[model samples]
Target: MTKEIEIEAKNIVTKDEFVHLCSSFQLKKQDFHVQHNHYFDTAHFDLKEKQSALRIREKQHKFVLTLKQPHEVGKLETHQSIDKQTMDHTLATGIIPNGDVANQLRELGVTTNTFTLLGTLTTSRAEIDYKGGTLVFDESSYLSIVDYELEYEGEEEEKVETTFGALLKEFNIPKRDTDNKIARFFKAKAEQS
Candidate 1:
């Protein structure tokens, strides 16, 4: 298990803006890869109510369970690696494995067993190093909805904001409020229901 503080700035973009950014950044088709995020929550969204989220991310045949919670500077992320069998069992039984992530949820008053598979969101993503941060371009699809986003993840909040802002200005992309993938997925799920 590993823990980290995730500080990032992000904005939603239009399809045309997404393409334009790709062109400006010289991101080729091969630069992109696909990842699947399987979100989980209790029936009443207990975790969501606490401003926390849990997910098992599958990338390149590997799975990592992560729990994100509110923190002073940014979201605190706890990650634990799991195998395919574990992933399947959790999805089928709504039981999380014994690990730091589960422990963190328990600390947040969220029982591990209460979680059920909410849904999955798949994204075609590309990343590049820019201004001492990782700049990400994502086109994600979930529940018949597709969206584009640009994110800058870095250690320093001020740098992340300034760098991300400059990039948007450079490309003439408008700055719009953007929810993280899990939140967006939850919103889409609610709309569908």
Candidate 2:
């Protein structure tokens, strides 16, 4: 089991802005990689109601199960690495293997018995070091949705926000309230239903 406070500031960026940032920041093609995120929730979206998200992310031949819950500065994330066999089983059966992540969800009133795969979002992402933090750019796709995002990850809460704000201002990117990828995916699913 792994625990951490994820402090990050992010904004929804336009395609042009994404291109501009990639060029201005000199982001290399080599740094870009693809990550597939499989999101899960109950029939009634119990976890989303609690402002939480559960996902199994596959990248670079590794799998990690993560549970993210709301926190003051950012989200608190609990991650557990699982083998491909367990991941395949969970994806096929909607039954999470018994473990800390399962127990954590149970404590939150979201049992694995009711969980199902809601959707999968794939992101072409790249990261660059900047201002004592990491800046991330993502082009994500799922269910007729294609969007770009800029995120700043930093150790300190206040500094992250400040630096991110400056970057936003410098680029003249308007501030728009952005939802987490899972939430956006869920909303799209709900709209189609």
Candidate 3:
């Protein structure tokens, strides 16, 4: 089982500055990479509130699934994620796993794409970008990524998730715009409305 320590933040950040911050983060010793992800989603299961979700990720080489039985305290009561990184046969589409990985993933529907990287010398915090739906370039002792983003394409609803940069004050980091490109994107959209 994979284990991680998560730290929740108040607001989001930008993408550009996050990349710059990666040079000083602690994930340098770990692996780092840049990726472009395209996701295929089904219907929206909105329950008017933050309801529990059962997520499954299908990749070119593997699959993963996680179920949040209940949505409370920003956490999941029960979660399971499985991946199949190596396959012995040619897959017509999506990743192929020999054993339980394939069986488990097939039982659920999950797919994801993101560019992940290790921190170089950045602070141990991450920010989210609401418009672009990218995790952006985030710096954390445990997690650092570049060119990373999550987008959900559904029939009637779409969701984009990303991280950004900001200056922290007294632990609660607020939304701080550090990239002009990102700022312009949001500003232009706002003005159009």
Candidate 4:
């Protein structure tokens, strides 16, 4: 297992803005890749109540189980690599593996067994190095909803905000409030229900 502090600034953008950013950054077709995020939560959305989230991300034929919890500067992310078999078993049975991620959840007063598959969000994403941070472009679809987002991830929160803000201004894009992907997925799931 590995842990990190994730500090990022994000904004929702229009499809036209997404395309414009791609062109301005010189992002090629090959820079884009697709990934699927399968979210998990209890029947009562206990994790959401705690401002935490859990998911197994499938990318490049590999799987990773991650738990994101609140932190002072940003979210604390705990990641555990799992094989395809483990991912499949958890998806089919709602039984998370006993490991660091589960241990972390336990600290949040959540039992691993209580989690069930919530839903999946798939995104076509591309990342580029910009202003000492990683700038990400995402076109994500979940539960009949599709959206575009721009994100800047970096070690320095203030710099991330400044750089991201400047980028939007340069592109003539308005700054819009953007919820994280997991929250958006849960909201969409709830609306459908």
Candidate 5:
């Protein structure tokens, strides 16, 4: 399993800032996720893209698993996750198994019409729990976005998450980087001007 250090910022930022910041920093885009993404006719999974990733989920001796995409990995660059978060760092955990996740998909307009399809599609995934930090870069989706989850571990299991627009500060290019969607978007935006 591969590993990554999730970066965190001090406060929330806007989409406009994300676009501007990326170009300002001269960050390049990379096709990092394509390697593991399993493309399906209608749905797929992507977490397996990193040759099995090692996640340092918040608190509780870090568990091991081949990073798995809990849902269909689409070309559109979209994803969803649940993190169990709390104020303390040592007790953090990420995965939360519950039925509410399906409802979340339906609320997001990602549901299907057939039961077979519904069973085939995945709406929720294992959670990521990190204390004093959260995941910033997602190698999925086509938007300039980042996510940070706070996890609290206990019998009750509480959680809180924060997602924001992202600004690619740098890209290693062909080696390790985003697919360059934000760059293309900004380029088109500049050309239209």
Candidate 6:
């Protein structure tokens, strides 16, 4: 398992804004890659209740299982790589793989056996190195939801926040009250229920 400290600022944007950002950043169409995130949770949302998330992401036919937990600095993410066969099996059976991810959930009092497939979110994403950070633009679709997002990942917290704020101001984009994609997906899933 690999642990990562994720510190990022994000805001929703319009399709025009997404296009404009790509042009402004000189990002080509080839820069964008597609990925599908399959989310999982218990029937009662045991993981969401703890502000945690579990997802198996497929990109270029590779699968990675990620667990995100709330943390003071941002979110603590634990990632484990699994093969396509494993991903397919889990999707078909609702049986999570045996590993640190499962152990972590068990520690949180979640029923590992009861985890269910939530839904999938697909995103076309482009990453660019800019201003001491990695700027990411994404267009996502899932259920009846379609949205664009801008996020900046960096180490220097203050600088990244300042840069992100400036970018939003420059684009005349308002910072929408938003959580990560997984949270939004879960909320959308709940609403449709």
The lDDT leader among the candidates is 4
Model 3: residues >4 Å from true position, as ranges? 1-7, 26-30, 33-50, 58-62, 81-167, 170-193
118 in model 4: Cα distance from truth in Å? 0.9
Residues 30-62 of candidate 2: C-alpha lDDT, one tens digit per residue: 879999999988878788899999999999989
- Tens digit of per-residue lDDT, candidate 6, span 11-106: 988999988988988999899999999999887888889999999999998899988998888888888999999999999988889987887788
Model 3: residue 10 alpha-carbon error in angstroms = 6.0
**Tens digits of per-residue lDDT for model 4, 97-148:** 9999999999889965757898899999999888788999999999989999
- Where does the lowest 10-residue lDDT sum fall in candidate 2? 106-115
Error of 6 at 33 (Å): 0.4
- The lDDT for every candidate, in the order shown, is 0.91, 0.90, 0.30, 0.92, 0.26, 0.89
Angstrom error at residue 158, model 1: 0.9
Q: What's the lDDT for candidate 3?
A: 0.30
The alpha-carbon deviation from the true structure for residue 143 of candidate 6, after best TM-score superposition, in angstroms, is 0.1
TM-score of model 4 (CA atoms): 0.98
TM-scores of all predicted structures: 0.97, 0.95, 0.34, 0.98, 0.20, 0.95
lDDT of 1 by residue, 1-193 (tens): 8999999999999999999889989999999999999999998889999998899999999999999999999899999999999999998988889989878888899874657799899999999998888999999999999999999999988888898899889888888988899999888887878
Give Cα distance to truth, residue 176, candidate 4, Å. 0.4
Question: Cα lDDT of model 5 overall?
Answer: 0.26
TM-score, cand. 5: 0.20
Query: Residue 144 of candidate 4: its Cα lDDT?
Result: 86
